[model samples]
Each structure stands twice: as structure tokens, then as C-alpha cells.
Target: MTDLDYFDQFDDEGTEDSASKRDSLPDWVSNSNSSLAAYQAIQSLYKEKMQYIRGHSKKSHYTKKGSYHISKSEVARAAGLAKPNAIFHSVDYASKLTKELNDKNALLVASKEKILLSRSSSIKDLSKKELQSELRGRDRYKEISELKADEIVDLTLKRLPLDVKRQLYLA
Candidate 1:
């Protein structure tokens, strides 16, 4: 066959596949003929990408990458749009999505900081005598159990508060 005919055959198959995909889309996406519909389509694709990145989805279409970040062009391409800007044509929708993503990242960072702070603060909050006893206890446990230094530290931290409470009750 001529090159033109060969390519035409693939094009016809692609059209049929795309037509089937279009039929499977949501009723609103298939029925509407507006820019809003395009935006909605891109939004849904974006959520799917996020879900895949977060390991919440097992869809083969979204390949896992080293970086979790998703871009505007990726969403646009997934929605079969020619231009990424077309997806973000609605300023309100674009800004709202951006704000939501930022807020989620901010909350994640805040919670991580809180956990680190609590861990360090627990060690620092102990009095000098308590701190000394904690270290001595860790060493004793290490020697007795032949455990690694890191494991001993973890064990001591887990037991510290309870030990303090017992000492308080005794005194």
C-alpha cells in the first residue's frame, strides 16, 4: 500500500477508538458543547493523575514517575486538547484548583513539622536527672539485649513517659 493509504487506515482506527472513548465519558461531558465542559474534562483528568501519583489508583494510563508533580500540559494532553491554555481558559476554575492544591501541600507540611517537633520536644522536655536516667536505661537495655543503638533509642523514647509517671507515683 502507498504511505498515504497506510496512514489513513491508522487514522480511521483512531477515530473509531476515540469515538468509543467519547461515548464512555460522563453525560455532562458528552452532552455539553461549551468551554466549561472542556475544563471539567481536564479537571477530572487532573484528579486521576493526582490519584495515581498518590498511589490511590492502579490505572495503567498513568505511569508512576520519580516526581509526583503534575503539570497543566499533562492534564490537557490527557483530555485530548490541542493547547494546555484551553483547559485553564476559565480563570476562576484554574485559580480554585491551584488554591486547593497549595492548601493541601501546606497542611501536609504543617503536620510533618508538628510530628518532628513533638519528637524532639519530648526529649528536651525531660529534666536533667530524667534525661540522665533515660540514657542510662537505654545503655542498660542495649547491653542486655545486644540491640543496636538506634533500636535502643527508640525503645527508650517509647518507655520514657511511662517510667516518669511510675517514678512520680512512687515518690
Candidate 2:
């Protein structure tokens, strides 16, 4: 059969007496008669073309030829977005974001632990000079970490809801 004749089969089986078919159809399908058979015919026309998303590419990362992994952040950067790891498209992008966030959180925890560890003695027992030295060390680390934290905040701001990020910023 000719390609043009292909649609004739689905159309004919669907029925000719449009009014009679309306009586047999369900309420939703019957109501669509206001648009004639256009919607139904189109749906039937592309039945084979419509496909469920089975899966995305399994590749762990996309690295341009001879280059390091092009992270989601990098992709967004290339696309001229303001932050990294902010866009979500597939499972891999979600995985990349999870790893980056978890890694940074662990660094923050480690820095806080270092400060706690530096205070070997109780504050009530330390000499004034020794206390100053310890405080200086903690402040140095805190300053460096605050820079990183700000970077993380910028990244998170691009991805998170504004109100949620506002609370984090205030805290």
C-alpha cells in the first residue's frame, strides 16, 4: 500500500459516522468532538513515534576529547551560566551535584574539627598569651574556610530556592 493510504486504515477502523462514534466513546473522548477528530487523528498518526524515556546515556562523565571531565558546572559555565553544578538534565548530572556538595560539606566539617582539636586545653586554664596564639590559628583557618564557604554559597544559591538560601545566608 502507498504511504498516503497508511492513515486510511486507522481512520476507517476508527469509524465513519462521527456522530455515531461519539455515542460509543467515553465522556472525555466525546467532548473532544468540538475539535473534530483532529486530536484523535493526530494521536493515532504519531502512535509509533511517541516513546517513553527508557534511559539516558550511561557514561559517568562527558569529557571533551583529550580533556578532563566536563562537569555539570563546566557545562553550565560553557553555556554562560553563573554557577557550577546548577543545571539538572539527567541522572548523571544529579550524581555530579551530590558528589560536589558532599565533598564540600566534608571539608567544612574537617575545618571545624581542626579548630576544636587545636584547643588542647580548657580556656579557663590557658595563659593569656597562649590563648591569643590559639585564637590566631583558628582565625586563620576560619578566614580561609570562609572564602570557600562563600564560593559554596554562591554555587548553592544558583541551585536552591531563594527563600531556603536566604535562611542559610542569615544563619
Model 2: lDDT equals 0.45
RMSD of 2: 27.1
- List runs of model 1 lying over 4 Å from the truth: 1-34, 53-67, 89-171
For candidate 2, lDDT tens digit of each residue in 1-171?
A: 998888765756645686776676434333422222322332332232121111211122212311222234433444455554343333333444445434443543444445434643677757688789999999987876778767877765688877886887943
Residue 20 in model 2: shift from native, Å?
73
TM-score of 2: 0.21
lDDT of each: 0.54, 0.45
Pairs that clash in candidate 1: none
Clashing pairs in 2: 73-85
